[model samples]
Target: MRTLIVSEFITLDGVVDSPGGGDHPHAGWTFKDVEFDEAAYEIKGREQEEAGCLLLGRQSYDEFAPVWPSMDEFAEYNAMPKYVVSSTLTDPEWTHTTVLRGLDEVAALKESDEPGTILVHASARLAQGLAAAGLVDRYHLLVFPVVLGSGKRLFSSDAAKTRFTLTEHAAYANGVQLTVLDVVR
Candidate 1:
């Protein structure tokens, strides 16, 4: 079975929206508010090295599809097979991209014989759904120090109780933290 991992850049107040530039008022908070630290971002490199495929929500896919393909840092993800969970997205222009109808398809993908990590990037809604459905195997988070008081969060308040064990953690000089948690199942 494949391991499904949700990876995100979040804030102290649990905000996961607009880490990169966006239309939000607090857009670009990640780069603007926090000091840059290469060590804090090492987890990203490790994730790229370990990931077998990419899974994204429609919104995230819309946001990333155009940009990630051209970015050198995201080359691995650009090359890997990508699955976007969306009923509306019929044709994905990104190379090796496929559209999944819903959670059932996602679950089936998890149960498939492909035996490597399915890394989920900036798909907050999809991550929340996957968590609620108990499909997520692990989470890799880089917690930034700044908090945008109002923005979409990674976890929903109505989500059911879930438990996780911290498999790895590290603190960087810029106060950014790396936390890797595995679902307790």
Candidate 2:
């Protein structure tokens, strides 16, 4: 079975919104509030090296598809198999991209014999659904020090209680911390 890992750049108050500058009022909070540290983002490079595939929700897919393919930093992601969970997306323009209908497809993907991690990045709704369905096996969170107070959050209030064991952790000089946790199943 493959492991599903939800990786996110979150805030101190658990807000996962617009870390990379989107339509949110406090867009680009991740970069603006925290000092830049190369070591803090080492986990991102590690994730690209370790991940076998990438998964995203419709919103995230739409947001990333046009841009990430052109970014040299995301070449690894562009080369890997990308799965977008969407009911309406019929044709995907990105290379090596596949459209998954819903959570059932995600569950089936998890049941496959693939070895490396199925990394989920910035897909809040998909991550929440996967967590609600008990499908996420691990999480890689880069927690920043700022708190926006109001924005889209990674954890949903209606989700069932789940526990995780911290497998790896690191604190950078820039006040950004990296936390890797494995879901206790």
**C-alpha TM-scores of all predictions:** 0.97, 0.98
Clashes of 1: 0
lDDT by residue for model 2 (18-94), tens: 99989889999887878899999999998999899999999999999999999999999999999999999999999
Pick out the ten consecutive residues of candidate 1 with the lowest summed lDDT: 21-30
TM-score, candidate number 1: 0.97
- Model 2, which residues run further than 4 Å from truth? none
Residue 104 error, candidate 2, Å = 1.0
| Cα error, candidate 1, residue 180 (Å) | 0.7
Q: Clashing residue pairs, candidate 1? A: none
Model 1 misplaced stretches (Cα beyond 4 Å): none
Which residue pairs collide in model 2, if any? none
Error of 2 at 161 (Å): 1.0
